[model samples]
Target: MDNTLSRREFLRRAGMLAASGAAAPMAFNLSLMSEAAAATAPSDYKALVCVFFSGGNDHQNTMVPYDLKNYQAYATIRQSIATPRDKLLPLPGLLADGRQMALAPQLAGLASLFGQGRLAVVANMGPLVQPTTKAQYLSRSVALPPKLFSHNDQQSFWMSSMAEGASSGWGGRIGDLFLAGNSNAALSCISVGGIGLYLSGKQASSFTVGVTGNPQLLWGSTNLFSPSYINELKVLMSTNKTNYLENEYVKVTQRGLNTSVQLDAALKAAPALSTSFPAGNSLADSLKMVAKLISTRAQLGNNRQVFMVQLGGFDMHDSLLAKHPPQLKMVNDALMAFDSAMIELGLQDQVTTFTGSEFGRTLSSNGDGSDHGWGSHHFVMGGAVAGGKIYGRVPEPIIGGADDVGQGRYIPDLSVEQLAWPLAKWFGVPDSDRYLVLPTLARFDADALQIMR
Candidate 1:
């Protein structure tokens, strides 16, 4: 082992290798000891669900500014592609803290959640090394995420506090800490979007399930094989296997098999909901599986859980005006159905769902499309949320200005670490142990925490 490679450096290298399709097995070897051994854990039951927009999401339309002044600015920026304000659904009342704004018509499903105090918007958030001002950003004195505006890097940074070049994800780090308590050691974190570095913790990695609901075994239906062959397969995977590589491979396969068994059992035990998810849709189906899993938390013996579901096609580099609406509608309907399922199961207050993306789009349109930029807006929904209000600073729509880097790559007022740390803390992590999950949070001076009940 190279003693000189810092944890951050090691993590970056690991992420790079993993992203390039390397099959490096992650083995979290940290102590199973609880955070600080003396800090208080969450007394209430809670779970965090991350709805990841796989590609860059255009925040310009999702959280629209209906107010006259901001609307004018926004209309000027978006021009022909802007979602008309008349279509925006006005908020029912002043948000909990009195700041209220309407959302695009496509987001009416989430609008209803807002009226019910079940959704909140966190504005202009992205990855940052520290509190970077325009001067520092221009002068290149402040440490910034490497390769800003690149999809791969920003996505990596969003999922793991470490930049796209990082190795260990913050979520994986958190999973490692709680892996010992998970009933299904085969899976502590679950992803509908397949294998990701964020869920690749040292000891606990994400168990992936397809939205199509098929986790087929690598070796299935071997009726032609003799009884001896079946016996050999079983014996090869036994706990006492002596061959190192073969044993490791068998263990990996067995873990996947165990996860499938446990997950299927849990889903079968869950009560069917009256709410119908949209037919033949990936996002809707993913949410349905999440609902089923949450219903069987007791059987799975997980007091805290995190799930990731992704939907792509937000990178509207061209033809955005025509292509954006349908994608937004899909997200809206999927979220609506997911929330309703939670209500039916009476787990509304127990689970919180939030949106994340690589970054935001540029204010100025690139002919028929929007270019990749920084500092995108995000939303959170759950029965426990302080809905109808927007958190963080919404940037002014100015191109090539102080906040806007040329075509509106706005400096984010809130870092993703700042946004996610509180949720992790709420899910039973101690104050002292927060560093273990989000170490880069310290670099950004993102010390302020707590976002929900």
Candidate 2:
């Protein structure tokens, strides 16, 4: 008798598996099972924190070209949305090319970090199927990332290197590679941000946490219900499970409870941070929790960790001038506090933090705001980063310049995978298995940006 199931049968079973709180395996060219079989334990500890700027961000305003020539051109095209060149905070260390670069007025903390040589920028980076040029983009001669400038699709692609609806993001895949090394494998990938594809992998799963660092459960109470009710609830969920599905549900609930208990114990045992995180700032709250986890990594018994935190309201389509500044200020304050906390813990070199967005907005303004565009500038911050430098090409701000596809929406000179390569390598994924974490790694020059030490 044949053992193979028909396609419809497979789908039916897969749906059942999903409904039972177990993730159905994602199909890929190389099985993640093979990756698990070859997995090696990491000897040392490190964490990668992804700070995602939700909605399309205007990279043009984030890092401005400050020389007389470039500044004029940038200001000319940007119009009402331009940050005055005088108001920009000048970075003291090294300037890109022959021109000085400055951060927006709100990003004072980041500018100071740049001067201290702890932060760097990767310019004109975006998702691409292969090397693409402005002409190629216009003519459709080269393959581009699907659904360009789309909010959800670009966000998914930026995180997973796949289009929307993709399972298994790169962060979780990295968690998969080092699952054997972790004493508590389930804690390898964590998310303080929303449920993004960035934190799910074929074999690795994300454990969600809130901003305050306290562990939570799906079936347990927080403020409204008493902690004493947890035992009663756990017993109720686990009791009298006869079938496999029921048993699996009980197991998932138990796993969550265990993680909650373990994390709560570790957090309570750890010393509080001397560094201060701003109150009521969502990003700061998330990063503060991440710092706490990093400090308590030993108690959690994980050698490698991946974390995600996010900030939103970057979709400055209609009110660029009025809306963008406060967001930048929040980012600046949160990033500074997180960096200080890492330094205080003597883990500055052990942890790397980076910023990302779905896509960049157009350089040319449409009266009130800017439109979504292709390439964007991003920041890499940590002691190990080759800071005070700009990696990849900075797009010329001229409306119809060499790099612009149209409307000053610059074409990317570097792919998103190229930016992730060096960071993943620094996080302890070896060259051979880099492709496991980043599926698009094969198409780009690995570690070309060379941002890490």
Candidate 3:
């Protein structure tokens, strides 16, 4: 008469249901799938690459205010980690309020991109439901994103406009809008960074691949298994059982097998890239895989795609000066190589890469390093970008300026919706469908940023 199930029993049943594909539809919205299936293919190819900087990045150090007046304020506040003035890579003619900004010496590759007009800096961006000022933030006048300084929550907020437990990401929603445009909807949103919330949609989810351009095969499903075992597994996957759970598992397994074959063939057919990514850089490895995937777009029958890659270790609560340079250099080198690879592939203008972080570190150092704060600067680069300029208002590098909330954490002048909307518009999402991708976008300005050509 006891109905209670043991933990192992519950998990076993859940796994069986998942394998049967009974849980797949529950993971996504069926109505959204129908809508996406009805949409037509895009006329031309375009892709968005999101390079997520896990852990908060220190924007003050990344994008330095090099002009004498501002530099003094920055150095005074960040005494231990300040880059020397003369050593800074000067960004000639890219000035904000008559004060020139420069990249740290470590970011020489990005500096070159800036000089070549292939990159633009987006200043002081963070998640906001609406336009908010320091006064509003202080007075609790506007609804703010939950858990402002927490890494996981802020990362989710930036990607999905909600804290943790958000069902869909803006990128995934974008993928949902264009899933039908691709021959294989499963591959429309690819992630080299593993399964990220940023690429989880109601109707579409990311197809994760390794840095080596291989699809993630299910356990015991590869050539290492015995022929008889593989055959039995295939038979089980192909069986059309009447039980709902078993049927779902078969469907999901079949889909995975098909996707693996397709991806492997496409990757094999892709031309080798000549661009040299830095040796031993994990970020570079991820970007290299993304480049290979992009090269296989035609073979995969994709006109629109979204890709995500990540690099961690930015949460430098200590050793900021000792550690930040090499990390930044790795990012710089990988991005520059990726840009070159795009050019070599003759798809420079068709691809756009941008940076996102959970939040920015405090402008004021906590002796050895900085703590989590808000309003970080980021970069957007591609042949189509209207580059060599700063897009948003640059906050004065003062500890207690009008923009600063506290400890030089400037309240963001631009929202994540503002940053994402332009990219979505450029990717061919119609204005009517923009709300589906960015739920908070309607509250902010409808006009897309002029950063794109």
Off by over 4 Å in 3: 1-35, 94-96, 215-232
What lDDT tens digits, residue by residue, belong to model 3 across residues 413-432? Answer: 89999989999989988888
lDDT of 1 by residue, 248-304 (tens): 445654454345556666776777778899976678888888777777777877766
Against the correct fold, how does model 3 do in TM-score?
Answer: 0.90
TM-score of each: 0.85, 0.89, 0.90
User: Given candidate 2, what's the lDDT at residue 201?
Assistant: 78
After TM-score superposition, what is the CA distance of residue 115 in candidate 3 from its true location, in Å?
Answer: 1.5
Of 1 and 2, the candidate ranking higher by TM-score:
2
RMSD of each: 5.4, 5.0, 4.2
TM-score of 2: 0.89
Using TM-score as the measure, the top candidate is 3
Which is superior by lDDT, 2 or 3? 3
TM-score of 1: 0.85
**Off by more than 4 A, model 1:** 1-45, 92-100, 212-214, 217-232, 239-242, 445-450
Better of 1 and 3 by lDDT: 3
